[model samples]
Target: MKNVVLRASSMTQSGKYLLRSIQNESMPKIDLLIRECLQNSLDAAVSRNKGEKVFVDIQVGSCETKKINALFDGLTKELNKRFTSVTVDYISLRDSNTVGLTGPLKEEDIKEEGNYGNLRKLVYDFGQPQVEENSGGSWGIGKTVCYRIGIGIVIYYSKIKLAGNKFESRLAAMLIEDETSPKSLLRSAGLKNGNTSKGIAWWGNEDINGSSYPITDEDEIAAILKDLQIQAYTADETGTTIIIPYIDQQALEINANPYGTLQGKLKDYIGLAVQRWYFPRLYNKEYEFGAYLEFTINGYKIRGTKIRPYFQEMQKLYNITTKAILNDNQNVEKPSDIYIAAIDMNSTFSDGRTAGFVAYKKYNEAELSMLPPNNEPQPYTLLLRDDDDDDTGNMPVIAYCRQAGMVINYEINSAWTHGLPKLTEGEFLLGFFQPNGKKRLRKPDGMSGIEITLDEYLRSTERADHSNWEDKEVYGKKQRIIEKIQKNLPKKIAATYEESAEERKAKADQSLQRNLGKAFLPPSGFGKAAPVRPKTPGKPPATPVFKTHNLSFKLEDMSFSDNGSVCVPFSMTVKNGLDNIHLYLKAHTSQQEIDPGTWEKDIGSNFPAVVLYENLELYLGKVAYTSVEPVYSSKHVCYGIHISQLDSCYNAKGKITLQGKLYFKHNDPTISIRVVAEEGDR
Candidate 1:
């Protein structure tokens, strides 16, 4: 224990360092712990067919320190010593039906190039490389997590099942601190080995030189546990249980959740963190042993039926995931069990051409209302590889991954805005780009999951994204992966935002004003069968009223709108009650509506005394409207006789209102010289 350090000069520094190593963009330290722990269990299960049923249990206990006996005085190396008593908390993790830590008892037993047992893989080494394909953690740092749980005091007891009906038990303690002299090594634990290993301690009576090896003898194991008043391993079971003698007091205070009537304890929040991040691996068909989780702190417990309510609360995510898998990422499609999206992204060095469906899930606003408080939409873009358990809820709004399913970087949804259409507030997008695992079948979606796959990337972080979600830098040789994704994925998803023709029309012209009344002003009455401008031009611009042969007409007022509607006010008096009066409007240039012609003989018989054309009968008192709803004065219209009732029009160009044509409903609906409005007797 000379060069090596075990105990921290500061607990906060040690705790923070351990936390930072396991933390992810989307999860808290506790969540990262749960995910890493259960995933390790799953990887262990995959080692055997029957071990697939992985049920992991967690127990948190708070107890006051009992007088620790047998402490060796630094100078004399004698036992029969005591230490100060303090209230300590502990958490234990027990996984059933697992191949417990059964392997080399010491570093000497390990080989240069061969298989090792969990015991050595965990205790004897720090940062030991894992041999399993699906196993997690970077450099075996995860194994030390238990030791970092409290004031750095953790003991491991494993009951291993051997061949036939045999079983062996192993007990060891691991502690780390500042290096000390051989005679006075406070950071030391486990077998003394006469002067050999000082890190791991085993059960057995001390030998001549004060060194003790593991007590493999079954009777000895039982007698030792019985003597210490500790629980003995059951005869029929085999698994590993980790014990933390002292938990971090500051960690509890810092991570405790303040939400409900009862302030959530640190351990209770950790239990919730487990539920948030590990549910993906734990959810099952209820009866089956897919994955089991349990957490307890003090009097409170997150075990058995208690997890149901928490689990059920995440049902909204299932619905979203269901859409991605079965309905082609749309709610309208008939749901199918499988969904696939092919991705094809290629940088000069790396190629990402894989077919898979993008999976996305988030707690929507409606779902958040159902939960009591604190809990909100937990959005996670599930790419292939995500190694974390911290449920602190800091996540990349959009996660970018590679073919192996490892998320290289967790990115924010806004990061894509530079290359795509702008997104509105309250709108979120999460996509899971997964490569097909089975027969390399062609899929369009999963093809381009990775952007920059530089050969020299992350020599230290085990291909994990080291930067937090908000950190943005042009990565790789020349902004390779990030640039490539921005060049394509945004354009594709943006196309889905297009609107239909009917939808456009409904939104643009829902009001009557937009649907302007249509009127066609065709020509008539010419020597060439064209319009005839009658010789009825009387008064000049200075005169307000003009007299025709039969009646008096006055140009009251005229108005035109930028939106193509026109309004005109005209007054006509024919002495007695005027005959049928109607307003005709047509949309024309500043010029004319019809060509006029003179009265000709037989050759130009097409010219009539009057000609006929298409004209609309306007509703009384209504002119073109400025607003959606027409506002009119009842007193504005001539008595009894109707003038016009015009709301806003939808015509490309609103119809033009002609000079007031006063005409009685004769045999035809054309302008008649006799009924034309003329000046009154005044």
Candidate 2:
């Protein structure tokens, strides 16, 4: 058989670029692996029948060491050390429901664009540029992750549905062990060579024309796979399954990802990594930018079951995108909330990518509804990270993706952060940027924001993350886009937006004070003398409603009076003391004697306060003056609290209690006094 030893120079250069070169931190090596392989799969994916998402299976299984018997005559002596310690453990990542690798096995001698020669290119070439728009890996360095995963070795197997109803299968392997030493014998699985360097090992017989193809005989192929201790593709499957053998536990350990670790095992870590990286595609219910689903890691589906626990959090993020964060049209009906804008721009000044994209939804800290902490409290926070403070979830950088739904980068670097708007008052932002794949997506004419044609010029560094783009134009454009969003979205979101962390705390405290809760008071000790009636029974006792404030009250406000004798609006809370009783302030004096300063109600200038509590609303409670003349009082102040809207007092069994305050409008000074209780012991 003719030997096909690849040029040593080309091999060395590719190996250096992919494995030997330390471009960035090694912890993300696996992430790079996941990103690239999956990107390729999705690019070649097709709906099962008409409209269905693609399915991927990332499996971890083992084989017996004796099974892999591929050997060379003189090479065995030199390769013994290399092959001796290799565990039969392997990770078989396969993607089904896709258009199987359907292309010529080899590139034609004459160069052409649509050569359909993927199998040959993937098996033989390195750093080959992909002409497809939605294709990933601008530098093709991502494929080197396979070599990095193991001791520099990778295998490929594909099952293709050819013309008519026929099917075809092929297999290839790449080995990148350093060849600097004389004893080192690095070889790949390819054509069997009795002459020259052992290069290609064909699963099938060579054609009459000397062209190699996979062994079509299922029995032969199966036996060969079993012999080599390699995973086999399913007969009915019509896609690709990659086997990363000699699983490198040491490699994974040496990387030591302190942040994103999963159990200590590489296999376990892989599962978590998959969920973290590909969650968006799996949770794509909108079916707009991404259509990936049914992800399984080590046989566990990442959708509703294995990843079910994270769904609530993922949904919190997903809902923001599907339902806009700021879209508020009634008829044509925009999404619930979103800040839309054109993302397209110039390539001359920016990174050289053609600008185009649609639909960007902001998850500005508040919109995420309170993410969980990444540290530990049962469920993890978003992306399983509690960076920054380590107790709270970090605001993720906007996840930017190509049109094919393949994530290019998560904008997590300083370069990206420097360009983004600074979060104020604990306000951060996360926007999902979905660039249109060379399509012009127009915003609805009735929509409030401008059209979104985002120009995403990701002139990325070797890290594959566009973290270090110094292009003034690209940064300038992106900054301008963010500035515009900041200027517009808040105004619209202010209408129905969820309260920020600080606001939530204030509102909750306010509600707690105003709403009377069930009393949990300690049992009173038995007393020998039980008074039939206390002295001065008609007089209401003066007791502070809450420790925080002492409020002056009319005795009539405490009693169930049919006449309009009292109007008191106040918030009271109690702790430390268990006086589990509900009491009201009564007017100790007559209505005329208890007269308050009267002022004309003017809403625009100085209107009555609108005291809003969760359970009750004392419209006039916020006003400085208790009584306002007819023409002066705002409707709120005139109405006062409805019978249903009186302030309720509650106290917990603790050393904390709250008191109320009565403010005079003209002087604006508060009158501090204990609330007068009704006749009851309460």
Candidate 3:
């Protein structure tokens, strides 16, 4: 029978091909894989700590040549034991409903439908492949997904325990046959095991397809594992540890240029991933077992959990509690209230208080009877652990009632999905037994109970910031909650008549009359001509004012956007001897003077000469004004002056060029002055 079974297995190569596919297929993203593993670690710790929160701390740094390090600490030891070593040849980030071993590559099928990529080699590893019973990757294929990403091999699970005890540690690696192949890319540059002390433990090296062996340094190995200590959760007993000598190539690249890539990608979760996952380890001050778990990433402690003040505030605001039933019959009794702490998903990294809540009520002796059933004649429901209970060991971490029981399944991803693109489909409904608290919410078979979906009810709570949260549509029943919330918002400010189309047109018309130039407008463009201050009557100085010229303002072209904002253009010019000042419709005042130069005399509309400068854009602070104010400045003489603001004028004197239009009305019309000043005018 044994010979027949072996022969039958050898007859077909499908299993071999499948294993090869796992070793050579497109590797799952590295960071995402780490995130999943880290998430699992946190889940385990929090569960074991009696609902104590967890957190993830990440440290990024450089290592030996071509190496980058990601030190994960908080609650890291258990993760090490659970996943002592993670290879890249195979992995699956998403869960599934179907049976059979699903490939990580299979997940990409959800969008690509199998056209993505495939694995080739059967990358081997020694680590606990199953995160939980009946979970995918239980056969150890998941760790291989990391192997394909240039992580030459994994030499982890050597020796690590939670309580500093010994356990089964697996160490493994692969021999690369090709440089171009993603699955078997070698880390060593053709250096065999015998050539270096680091590879002394391995068997004699063999040269195959230019591939070589790379050994992990003992010091480097210890350093990384030490950093993971802060993330571990352990008792006075045993535990586990897993180590991968190298991270994925992409992760290394991201670490190389953190500012340009990795930092930006993990900006939100980088600080919290480790912390949230290993919350209990971070906050557990009661563990006196002397470092039950030690996790270090490059020798840095991944802090535990941070108690958010906002959540504390929310607890104060509402007396939170969950109401549940014991059985499926209408006569089933009701359970006590459960207080829940808020866990805000949308809040900023610094705002730990933005999350929703976890509810729990005080537990009692007879409460087990009142609690939802766990087996037949009942359904599995959310289990609320009593912190005050003494008889229930940590094993009660998972409550097992008679027939039906409760399960608190947190959907962290929902935080990312909700309000992104659009509002959640409906109001979050949270009901233990809402319509009637005493009615039995569990089913007879004890599968899924009739408990209310909390998400639907709680989501009904209105968003505080409509512009921020309700900027889009709310589907189905949620529309009513949105409408109800909308009523409470402050009314929009009333629009003013000055902002009306008619008023804007009148303003434009008025501006047109002013910018058309003296040739086009009448006395509006003509400014009073002041006598040029003559040089000392007799003595002739080195410089002299050979000529003086005066120019007038003019109007030009105008345009506006749909919003009614206007843009005007004009021109002006002035000539004195060889110096000729020509001002295009657009004149910058700040270039010629420190401040705005105004006309010494006022214009028709009580408006002062304007101060205009390039890049001096001010929509509300300073209105966009257009006028032709040209000035000519030369050594021998100065002439033709146009001043916008008083600050730009030298004793109310500046030469203006008689070239462009200057007819736009100065709304203030306060300080513009026209003066004739020449060189040597003293």
Model 2 has how many clashing residue pairs?
A: 46
State the lDDT of candidate 3 residue by residue for 535-576, as single tens digits: 576853222122324443333444443422233334333222
Candidate 1 Cα outliers beyond 4 Å, as residue runs: 1-29, 46-51, 67-87, 178-232, 256-263, 285-340, 346-352, 361-363, 369-396, 399-495, 498-682
TM-scores for the candidates: 0.51, 0.56, 0.30
RMSD of 1: 21.3
**Per-residue CA lDDT of candidate 1, range 1-682, in tens?**
0112232232222323533454444433444455556555655552343214665666665544442222111211221222244544566666666677777665555676555677766655555655543244435666554543554445667788777978789865554422233532343333233333333233233344443334466665565444333455687677776766556645654543322222346665666655544443444322122333323344355565445442443323332333333333334342243222333454323323432234333333333332234333223212212322111112324443222112334445355433433222122344444322221212244455434222112212342222222212323222333344444555555454557868755643432122221212232211121233444668333324444443444444332323212233455433233333332221122343321122122122111112111121222235532211211122111111233322232233433232332211111113221112212122
Which should have the higher lDDT, number 1 or number 3? 1
CA lDDT of each prediction against the hidden true structure: 0.39, 0.43, 0.26
Candidate 2 lDDT over 218-255, as tens digits, reads 66566656755555667667878777766766566445
TM-score ranking from best candidate downward: 2, 1, 3
lDDT of 1 at 78: 24
